[model samples]
Every structure is written in structure tokens, then in C-alpha cells.
Target: MTDDQTLADTTPPAAHESPAGGVFGDPTAAPLQPPTVRRQWSIADILAEARVPERYARVCLRADLEADHERILTELRTLIDVEGNIIEAEDASLGEETNTARAHRLNDELEQIKADMAKATWWPRFRGMTSDEFAVFNKEHYPKKDGASLEDYNNQLVAATMHEPQVTPDEVAALRKKLGMKAMSNLIVKATEVNTQGGVDVPKSPSSLQNLTRQ
Candidate 1:
């Protein structure tokens, strides 16, 4: 053999090794397919894939009900809060309505809500609060015969605890109850806005999601 031919004939073949072993290493193995690139979800892409053009509907809430709902919500929250607490004779000066009267009104309003609104969406928010939680909240905010603002109450509480190295169990309990009440207020406010039927206006669909039958 010539020098180049001799070198070619004597050289070992490259190892028939495959990074992907098992059946993949076989000489007759299929070619490695490229990995798929998943496209990110996009609202515009979703719209483009639709078989039909989208339509829109408009809903209008009653202006007067929208305006008054806040007052109603506030009253309900207060009623839940002060249901069985010993309110000082002085703190009772806010309105002619006694705590009993206020509570009665709240019950009436809740009955009205149950009658008019979506129970699954709205009722659970306020109903979850226990009587003790409401009482603690009312006590924390409206102390018996005390004209202290919430900030003042906090400041006094902090000052009282300043000498201590860590919060006492009672202090911790009080703080947690105060936070719970604040959280309940937020939840109640949001629940008050859940259903279109709660408003004086007729329930209507959004400007989007047009009804196919209507068109």
C-alpha cells in the first residue's frame, strides 16, 4: 500500500459512542430532533386564534345606590363591631340609634343583601367574622368612655409596653385582634361591591363578552 493508504487502513474507526445511550446509540438511531421553543402567552395572540370576532356589552350601575353603598357598608361594619360590647354612655352620642337598634338595622340590611345579592360571592365575607372578633375590634377602636383616636390608642399602648423587653401575650393578642378588625373592614367594603344587583341599576354585562344571541 502507498503511505497515505496504509495510514487510512490502519487507523481505528471513531468510537461508536452516543451521548444519549441505549437504543439511541445504535448506528441506525434516528436523528436528534431540535427542542421545541414554547412561545409566551399573549392576549393579542389569543384574540388572533379566535374563530369569531368578539363583541362587547355595557353595564351601568345606579348612581344613587353607588353613592349610598359606602354609608350602608360603614353602618353594617359598626353594627357587627359593637354587637355586645359595653359602650360608654358618652360614646353612644354619635347617633340616636342604639347599638341594639344599629344591630337590628344591620340584620335587616343583611337579609336584604341575601335576598338581592349573590350569596357565594358576597355573603361569606362578613359572615365569617365571629362575635368575639367583632367585640375585640369595637373595643380596640372605641374604648369605653375614652375619646382617644386610634393613633393615640396605639401610642399609649406602645408607651405602656416600652419598659418591657418583649410583647406580653395579652399585648400580642390585642394587636392581632386589632389587625383582624382592620382586615375585616377591607373585606366587608369589597364584598359590598360584588354584585350589580346590589345596586339600583339593572344587572348588565361588561362592554366586552358580547352576547351572541343579542347580535
Candidate 2:
């Protein structure tokens, strides 16, 4: 045989070619994609993801009732000295009957004050919403009247935010009646603060940290 013909006869086929002359690999096959990377969350990221921010406030429905309670406590202290001894007048002018009557009256007043106090104090808890939720809430509830002043809009917003408490309308109404406008407004302020600020102690920013560490 001729040298060129002999070489051609002995030559191996291309790696990608089949014995029957068809291509061994599919050229139309999709290219291999990079592997997906699993995200590694930091402690702060995990905390933020899991956290449901909340704020709490103690509201005094009746300041006068608290003052009355303190006053009664003082009077009781005077009637019975620090050592638990009853003090008597020099002339016994204030007789046993008078002292007993005074003691009974003070006890009754103190009992009444305690009863009033049970209804006078409230610990209202407020929860902050996610940004998406707050955006939707603002869109749905924010005042958009043509003639509404800034103060009117703010008041409406605060009221809407405070009403987020999961109570019935009747319960809210009763609380409002007892709290008066001033106390109710204060609650609204607290609610707004929590909702907007997240009511959490945030880690200091890098700039603030640098400032704190400066000599």
C-alpha cells in the first residue's frame, strides 16, 4: 500500500466522532451552568429575619386615683408609727372611738382607691410592621382629603396606628373614654415611635463606632 493510504487506514477516529460517522456528543445540548451558592446568614441577619419588634407603655387612666392612693398610704403611716405602735394624744382628747372611726374611714378609702387603681392602669403593647406592611397600611389608611391640613392628617395617621391594638372596637372606645384625649394622644405618640423606629437598640453605625473608639 502507498504510505499516505496506509497512514490514513491506521489513523484513529476523532474522539467526538462515532463509529458510524455520527457525532458522539450533542452540539445542541445546553451548556453547564455554575453551581448555586447557599447563602450564609450572619447573627444580625438571622436576628432581623426572626425578630418581631414590639414596644410597651404604662398608661395611667386616673392620675388622681394614684395620688389618692399615696395620700392614704401616708395617713396610714401616721396612724401607726414605723414600729407598728399606735400613737395616743396627751389628753386622750382623741378617744379610742374617734381613733377607731378614723382608722375605719381610712381603710375604706384605701380599699376604694385600690379598686379604682385596678381599672386605672394599663400596659399597652405595640408591634412594629415590616416596611412592605407599613407601606400598604399607609396607602390604605392615610388621610387624602383635598382640604385636610398637615395636623389633621398627622392626627388621623396616629389614631390609625394606635388602633392596631388587637382589641374590639368597644374595648378601644372604653379605653379612649377613660384615657381622655391627652392620654390617648400620648399612646398614639408611643405607637408611632415604635412603628417608625422599630423599638430596638440598633448596633452603632461604622462612623459612630469609629467616633466612639477615637482617642
Candidate 3:
């Protein structure tokens, strides 16, 4: 017999005697439903369960780091929008002194924002380790993909979030067309010499928030 079957054969039945009428102690009780079968595991199964703490911590750390990574990407997108707005304003200025002065001020503000972004402590202390420490952590916590190390994954994420535009290429083409038409309209308005009214300041540039890593 198999180990489980041999063990089951030698095991004793429930020690307690059934009550007078039934196990439920009711004389009129219908036959009790068979007890639900519970799962049984051997020594190997118990040993496997012991690894929960280590695995749980690793999973939690990965999830937390991923959350922070997303937050940093969001802040980066805001910075890009601000920069794009400055570009649009400069483009529409058409060499006007007031517009040029405004553009300079915006540029200065953008620089300050960039500095602050660089200074932001987006990751936790554990995640902010030295390069060697990070390598060790990645080796332990993250599995390699297609022969690339953890550092390769990290670099890919950085490049995608920081350097790539958020929108699809098709969407970017459409946005360019829209911007071109808007610019032409601005030029027409300028040529007409009509008194212009200030409009709401909204960031309508192509989004810089695409998850390029998936690509």
C-alpha cells in the first residue's frame, strides 16, 4: 500500500462514543451528513509551508516598490506637461517682448521643478541601496528574464518612463496635426490685429505618460 493508505489503515476512529440516538444526540435526527473531507499533507507539505514568511516578504517588497515606481512616473509626467506648455507658449509668442519675458520666467520655473524632481526621495531606504546591494537584492527577489539581469530591467524601466513619450506614435501624429492647426490660427489672429483675450491655461500637449516598458 502507499504511505498514506497504510497510515490511514492504522489510524483510530474518533475516540468519543456517539450519543444515545446519534452523534447529534437527537433521537429523531435524520442520518447525519458525511463529514467533509479535509486535505491531508505529509512531511514535505509541512516543510513547504514554512517558507511563507520569506516568500511573503519578497512579494510585499516587490509590490511596494512597484507602487512607488508608478508614483514617480506620474510626477515625471507632470514635469513633462509643464515643459510642453512652456514650449507651446514660446512658439505662440512670435518674438513679442511680453511673451518672451513670460517664456523666460516659465523656463526658470521649469528648471526649479526639475531640480526638485531630481531631489525627490521616491523610493524607500531599503530600495535606495548601493549598486552592489541592489544587484544582490534583485538576484534574491526577482528572477531573470530572457537572460537579462535585474539591472537590465531597472535600466529599461528608467529609459521608458523618462525618455519616451507617453502617447502612441499614431496619437502623436494626430496631436502634431492639431497643434499645427492651432498655431496657424494663432498666426491668423495675430495678423488680424484684434484685441486678444487670455484663455484658460490647460496642458493639451501629447501625453508623456505611456507605459513604454510594455512595448
By lDDT, the better pick of 2 and 3 is 2
Ranking by lDDT: 2, 1, 3
RMSD of every candidate to native, in Å, equals 32.3, 32.3, 30.4
Best by lDDT: 2
**TM-score per candidate, chains pooled:** 0.22, 0.43, 0.17
lDDT tens digits, residues 1-215, model 1? Answer: 11111211223347556554443334455745645986785999865763311111111222233334556667656555356552433466765768677667766775665444332222222111233543464467434554323433332333222222333435633544444333333322332222111222333333233344468
Give the range where candidate 3 is weakest over 10 consecutive residues by summed lDDT. Answer: 52-61
Better of 1 and 3 by TM-score: 1
Compared with the true structure, what per-residue lDDT tens digits does model 3 show for residues 107-207? 56656555554564222111123345435644654444454333322222222222122323344234334433323222222211111221223322222
Which segments of candidate 3 are over 4 A away from where they belong?
1-97, 121-215
Ranking of all predicted structures according to TM-score, beginning with the best and ending with the worst: 2, 1, 3
Clashing pairs in 3: 166-209, 166-210
C-alpha root-mean-square deviation, candidate 1:
32.3
TM-score of 1: 0.22
Q: After TM-score superposition, what is the CA distance of residue 106 in candidate 1 from its true location, in Å?
A: 3.0
- CA lDDT, candidate 2, residue 159: 47
Superposed model 2: Cα runs more than 4 Å off: 1-40, 43-48, 60-67, 70-88, 94-108, 120-123, 131-154, 163-178, 196-215
